[model samples]
Target chain A: MGSDWKVILCYSITVLYRLWWIPIRAWRLPLKNGERYFQDIEVPEGWHTSAEGRKWWRRYRATIIVPHALEACGLMAIALWGQWKQLPMLSLVAPVFVGMTLAFIAWWRHANRARIQRPQRVAVSLEERKLRTYFSWSLEAALAMLIAASWAIMAWRGDADIHWRWPLTLTYVVIGLIVMKAQVVKHGWALPANRTAEYQHWDEFRRRYASRVLDRMRFMNIVILAGYAAVHSLAGVAPIGAIRGAAFAAGLGLSVWMMIGIARGETAFLRGSARSLLPPATTIIDWKKGWWSFGAFMAGLALLMFWPER
Target chain B: MYLTVDFEDKRPLYQQVVDGIKELIARGTLREGATLPSVRQVAGDLGVNLNTIATAYRQLQEEGLVAVRHGFGAVVKARRSDFAGQDELRKGLRAALTQLVLAGLAEKEIVTMVREELAVVGGKAK
Candidate 1:
């Protein structure tokens, strides 16, 4: 309830919420591409409700459902725990709600992008289709479980009594398992389509654009890591409170900056005038598997959250 | 093995798959006794119905182009020594030529196109 506790709670919730959503965002990049590419197409009558269309509709629904459900369940669990314990953890939920709002705004902007209406049909490469399947079904689900388990286990193990912890833990774990099961789904073609020379060209451009954005993201991460290292290395001489506050501000600033940069970069690339594609289009690594990077981010945040109050 | 499907083409999906695989075989890209990608794999990769890919494989099996063994997926069957399908092949060629002629292709042009395609196949064989 106090300002200091509110700060700590907000910081913890921010890290956990981002960990849950970032992978979903990354994995849905292809689906986003499909939406953008088909934005201007005049599909045949009843295609959206046809068997082929329904298959793709299911994929999009599945893609959106898992992350939204996890966020909802986590919030409900936290709210229930707060009510039962008579705790003032509403501050913790504030930033997460803000994040969801921001995410929705960005998505709305993406959907409204100027439609280029190319004559080519919307098709995914064989490789992209497989990767989407693997991520949605296996990798992302596994990561979500780990995140939920870790959060629940730590919450139970930390200062809370066994009586209170069991219900909270059960709630969290049950939510996690349910979401994981639902996440084990494969995406289908957004449009009934195939790989062609033109599609290959588009894929190559996407890879080039994706790589450039990734390079920038990697640089930002390195800078943030070095900032933390510098702060920790100065712990001996600097006042601990001042050092911690500065480190928190710097880290949070870098994270917000990086996320905005990624969103803007994606938007610009999708709408960019540079239509030239590099030849010999190969299957570009989607980097949707950047869970390790996200893992490192969560680890850093966890370390900060549990840093001893001297 | 690589199997591609073009959804924009006028032909049925299974027929397109069959034609693509047949072309691969004719060019020796898929050699005799070589295994093909599983029906499931083809369907998954192409994002088509499983039954469509199965139908294509069944057609290939019927034509003696590939053998669909239970565990082995499909393998390009070795050319029969007796080779009694020439009449069938000739009939297919005539039908194809007739369609091309109906579509406004001249006889000389059709013959020239056929010769050019055979030459490419012959080159690949050598």
Candidate 2:
């Protein structure tokens, strides 16, 4: 393809790719803490018989399905129509991502308000939580190395007046995510009253995965930031595009890994119910926010590819 | 260690928490220097009031079974012989034996039951 055609084609592919992942909008039942379990994600078997489930479904369209449908259509419009304005895509979507994350934090606090309490015959050992308990050591090492490399590249590429400001701002965001994760795990967390032994095991398993999802979200964010830094630093070089390629590879690779791990669903939950957890697992990603980093990665890649008009 | 606080439990909520944690410490499920979940966390999990959990933690600290640090939650301290509640624990045990006696068990059955109970509670190791 011609150079301009190639650029336009890649940009279109990105926008179209994102639009395709439009929010899954799977209907859920009105069970308290139901989202944490799979039974709530889909129409429960024989749910047409349950008055509560059916009652909630009655409001499903106006309260959920319609509003969500409109929002998705609106976003689709922006993705398609906004291209002509040539607004830097990150500038377009970054605020939305940030707002969604904030919304999530708020929703999390709201949902986590203790709902049930009952005495059980059994006692469980409280597992001491640490960042490493969920996030792996090698992943930690990789993050450290990536940060070091990003700094190294920026130093090698820029003059004495390097743009330290942008990285600093991004660094603050990364720090915020860390604090958010800590807040999430540290909060007064509880289970539904009278959760059975099997349910408790399942909940704990979900929680561990939830914590890992938080770590993975942090890792994904850092990777995207590092990837951006590396490519931007390589602004003058051409063949070094291979190294630029690495950034996309790393981000994309992690997304795939996250996908596989979540896809191989465990516990008694139905298959594909994990789709409801795409954003950050039990922290609750849902469809739109779940593909958030992938969207961010694509936006960065498309922007960088089109930079310099090279 | 898992703890259940039945609303129907006869003991004070704080005492139940204090006893439950002590049992775990005795069992070595919670090792020295291990941190307990924050007061807010325990309160939320058990659906008890925050002050109730805090009171329990303070009692544990007073007894020297666990050390409470600001913002760091409670940490299991090394099992110390200097426990200020040594007599209190003794009285509690005597009360339990009295219950066994009142239940009209044969002396052998009572002795055997106490031993079995000790083993279950990790008191035998202690």
Candidate 3:
């Protein structure tokens, strides 16, 4: 514990920096990052110049900036106090994150409400909508299988009395998650303030982009949960300590990966330059990346499935 | 697929939906095998009742322009002009021609207009 003091201090400072950065970024969204924002959202041409666009921006700014600023101040006060008083500062991190998240939700809901009553012409694109459009079905299926097989193996070599508990409880939970993922994939959305035909196209593009990001996040979560599950199931097994360490390290690595994935979007926003909203067609089959990940996951599963008996 | 509902249109909402979709099919915008948005999706988008969109889809299915299968939603079957019998088409054509005549169009003018309308509905425009 004494030797780890420097690392702990460094982590707390990083957390404090991130907490301060969130609200500052949120506040600058309308000013410093405005152009990048337009690029990411692909607002229709002339949207920024139109009267309705100006009005919508006013409402949007008020909704986002004020609440976020207040939330940031409250978060910083608590975090600073915790740090100075030598209290358990890590507990403050989750509250700061949650507060920032809720602020985002509040503004998004407000923007959704500001869309005109009866959007009049609702446009769906010619192509069929599917989760597979944004996420790889093969990857999802592989995760489900990996989770089930892992839990089953854990059950098989169990302590006899409560061996069935994790498998039984988690199987239903996994099923529920898959269903929820399907439902939430392209469900309710906040339409852009500009609702032109071109904007509808942009909206579809935005939806797919957001869906892809969200699917990766969901996939990462399942991996993390499965890692924790693996840790629990192998807790007392000596030979599996290496496996356990790898699982734990992988969990932390993927948590950072997911955060970096989300932060990539924020970095694009803050870059203050227009990046192309339309990713070229050829790169889309990047769904191939999922198959690769699934293959690696399957390999790990194979190792674990056979390792138990040896 | 783009859809809109007018509060002021004298026609029933279901009829408007049916006609709008039929026009889209005629224009070749909705091609064979393309999936139509679900009835619930169209209804929610247009702020109309579910039955209105369902009736539109059912009418499309009966006309052979779309196939509405259970659970899979509706899919475009084909651009089915043959489904409309000759006499039924003539009656509608005669009413439109009569309106043009009442507006004092010359024979050449009426033919030109007919050609233009036909071209707009997927025929080759001269």
Candidate 4:
């Protein structure tokens, strides 16, 4: 494929993926609500009506999600512009990522404002806040490393085309899945402790998984770009052609294996009986809606597979 | 000025704050007649709303652990009669004993065990 065609294909995939995220984002708000209401049966003492308790929720939302959304948009713009034009994607993505990251720094200030503007009690606990912060930072660090590594791979292989490296992409996807599962498991375990604080529970689950999955998907796109570079570099060699063919076959095999594993794990998780293990203030997410959304995403992926790049 | 709140505890937040102040008074960290930080100042320092600290101070005032002046802010008044330096250790022991009892330890057995442990510690001190 010519360079322009490659750029166009990249841009198309980015747009397609962004479109897929729109429905998931819309679903997230209501799903969060459902989880909160469901988990509110047994909240711990001192959570509701406490000033610190109220502030925890404000910090969690403002510090975690708002900043994450801004960062994701900035990264998407970079990835989009880089592929659409010849300029370096990192230069565009990095500064914006830094700028958007300021939202988190402003979290405390925002929390104070929120507390003054609305004096309602927030139900999230200090322990929960610490856990969420740890997970959020870990995800952010992993994503940064993944992006840097992919870009480095591109720079290292200069003129050499690298085909879609399924292993690298799969690694990130697996990490995202693990993080999501861990979050859900945490919520499930916390259900019994403080049931009245279900809203905090649901918010934590959404905050952890949504940004995580989105970031990993963005990382996956960068891997796909690297693959595109590889394919373009090897347009003429007989031996390299044979190797590329084998890799493509292996990639397809691995993707299938991962899909089955993920589906099975999700099924088992959803089938298990619900336990009031989480704190009452925390929310327990409804797996039914989330699983349905996942299925929809998979179907979209299938369509992308058959879509003509030309 | 260092403060931490644990929301999961069954005790009310106001009670927790009062307990914390009582400990400070017992330890002489908050001396009699010493003015305490304004509720808003303490609340901001702890990342909590001002009302939480105010409620805590109110409880302390009711218990005579603190006296809230009109403009000067809350002040340490009289410490509890048992507000000696060893309240934390005593409180911890009481909690431990309660847990043991709840776990089915007989009262007599708990008393005997406490006596034995106290004897051991007393011997070491001597």
Candidate 5:
């Protein structure tokens, strides 16, 4: 494969991986809130019955999924336009991938809305709300750093072609940073003071909703880890030109281990029935830890990209 | 109806619900023969378990303010005829005064406070 194509392939693969991992990111946000946000939104009233539900859906789509889809489409368009000047078969893949991507987005939106509309009990406290916001931004920052560093290394080493893709990666990082900063401003840089009345209300909500929230997180993490494993395995097997085999190996191992840790933590929380005991701030801290680990993992991979074993 | 249940209030949700309803009955928000929303309806509206609502309704039934029909819903069975009477008001005021006294308030101070409160309520405090 030509150098240009390697760049295109790398960008495509990274975008696809990130897209698949979205649910994992989404799940982590609520869990990060120390399971408080989960209890809040999962309450027995239909999603349509509350103002918060509508806000959640709108922000989720706008801040996370829409930006991702737009970036994916833009990257794919650039790839196809590049290929159209040369290979027709490559152009064909673009339309199919784009269509399927849009379909998945639509399906996800519909399913989430339906789920929200169900009569579920949610008990949420201010502390939990703060945690949710904090962790979500942290996760985005971590993922964006990983993706950006991966692309940076690829560009620096001349392993991937399109230099223009740098701006898009930067945009993701900037957006993530802005979100995190916004959370800091909103939360006054401290965990909420204990409101016993609200805490009691939220405790009841958590007791009912914790299991479902953990299950959703586990399912999403499993899917993302599996997809990463499959794709990386294929990349290894294929006789692709200039494959950063070691970096890919390290990334896959770390991703799998991270997913396992997430599963283990979720299981422990569920089995111990410890959601009620754990403060909502703890969820944000755990989520922040996850992001730190993710950032370190990506940085490690980027290092590998610099010194490849030929 | 406004409903609040305090989990740490050393009172069960059902008991709290019952107490709230009793207060309503005492205050005459629930009139004699007034139909109450069904247990299922209240449970759905409050986002609580149906059993919680049932327990509250049962407590109200025991108090004779509510009666359950076979196919219909719980209905107010009796009115607290003296709910608004001076004796009942005095008893309520005495209960309030007793609570304050128990909390270390002096009787003379409470009497003076009550007189001033009455003056203010009567719009002659100025």
Candidate 6:
């Protein structure tokens, strides 16, 4: 009976967060980088709006919907079954499902690359420049603050076993450091003050592209941070070890899903830009560098956190 | 109709732009009286200089393929009865055939290839 609540809580947060994110992403679709904003694609003669572009968007929405629904249903069923049988491998199932969905998104982008509108170069306005810069630093700071707060709150409550606290703290610290490091990298590679007209044009587009991507990444981080807080808080509320473990696994899986989604988009962008006339301003940041560091950090932290508790 | 310019190609970018638009026009993908993307828009889309697009448009105007106006953008003009440039086309065909023959394509193969190209264009027009 106790485990049932844990499963429910875990699944509810995971599913609801993803459901919420999809609509937000679609609403901001026109704001993303593209040769023409999705909405700006030309319509046929005598038509005021673009019916073809609408169809394309509908297709994109449907593609995303099917995988997301499948993940939710599949993971919910797995979580329930795992709780009943005390299966260890069940925890691996959610990550696998998430991985498949992200891979599908990457493949879909590649397959449709030709059909998709090439990103257009637009003049970056003054207000737009300021807004992007503000969002960049603020979002990074907000995420770090959120993680640190969660760590502190969990420690102060003392309701959950502290045995896992050390590893959790370490995870938070490492993630915080990575976030900070990325900010420094951005600042270091800031667009030069004086540049040729061609380079300037390229830089404007690059900034717009980077800003749009960073905005999406920030939104995903919000989802991930919330997932972490929810699971960590479950310790005191649900005393059952099985239930707590299930919640933890669900939270961890969601984080991986969010990370993978961001990585997939960034990877597609990098690949698409390979043949571009203007490359990114500086050396491109490798997703591998960030993901591998995060992965190794998590693995090490998990060992320390879980082994001691066990 | 999309005008794709390959930055990596050795051919001059402006020439590629002109050729691409002409091909589209010949295939009927871009119909007469259609508005081509504005010079500014093309420059932005291709990440090339504004003058490059202007040069391409100017070449098209010379061929009587497109018309540029002050307020109005470049529009595909109807082909005149004379439809100039047949002599240039013959020259290009001669050069191409000479190369093909040198490369050992038989008379039969060259004729078959020309028919195939015409058929493809005809199919697209339909």
Model 4 TM-score, all chains together:
0.31
Each model's C-alpha lDDT? 0.50, 0.56, 0.55, 0.48, 0.47, 0.53
* Per-model TM against the reference: 0.44, 0.60, 0.62, 0.31, 0.28, 0.32
Q: What share of the true interface contacts does candidate 4 keep?
A: 0.00
Which segments of candidate 3 are over 4 A away from where they belong? Answer: A2-24, A28-119, A153-177, A184-197, A235-241, A266-310, B1-13, B44-48, B81-83, B97-112, B124-126
lDDT of 6 by residue, A1-310 (tens): 6546645555555556556556755434432434433322322453324675456556556556655566556666766665533332234444444444445444544554454443332221111122334355675687667767756755665445344544354455445445534442232111222232444455444445554544444444444444455455655565546554554665556555655555455445444443333333221123334456645655654565456544
Q: Where's the lowest-lDDT run of ten residues in candidate 2 chain A?
A: A277-286
- The residue pairs found clashing in candidate 3 are none
Most DockQ-accurate candidate: 2
Q: Is candidate 3 or candidate 5 better by lDDT?
A: 3
Interface RMSD of 1: 7.6
Segments of candidate 6 deviating more than 4 angstroms: A1-310, B70-72, B79-86, B122-126
As for candidate 2, its clashing pairs are A123-B2, A124-B1, A124-B2, A125-B1, A125-B2, A279-A285
Highest lDDT against the true fold, candidate? 2
User: What lDDT tens digits, residue by residue, belong to model 1 across residues B57-119?
Assistant: 898888788889764368889543223478977998889888999999988999899899888
- Candidate 2 Cα misplacement greater than 4 A, ranges: A1-25, A28-55, A58-68, A71-124, A136-173, A184-200, A237-244, A265-310, B25-44, B47-51, B67-119, B122-126
Return the lDDT, model 6, position A205.
Answer: 49
Ranking by TM-score: 3, 2, 1, 6, 4, 5
Worst 10 residues of 3 chain A by lDDT: A278-287
> How high is the lDDT of residue A67 in model 4?
42
- Alpha carbon lDDT of residue A150, candidate 6? 59
Chain A TM-score of each candidate structure, as shown: 0.39, 0.53, 0.51, 0.32, 0.31, 0.35
Off by over 4 Å in 5: A1-59, A62-310, B70-72, B81-99, B108-126
Q: Rank the candidates by DockQ, best first.
A: 2, 3, 1, 4, 5, 6
In the range A139-216, model 1's lDDT, one tens digit per residue, is 446644544554454443433222333333333333433332222222222222333555454544554444444434
For candidate 2, the per-residue lDDT at A161 reads: 46
Best by TM-score: 3
Which wins on lDDT, candidate 4 or candidate 6?
6
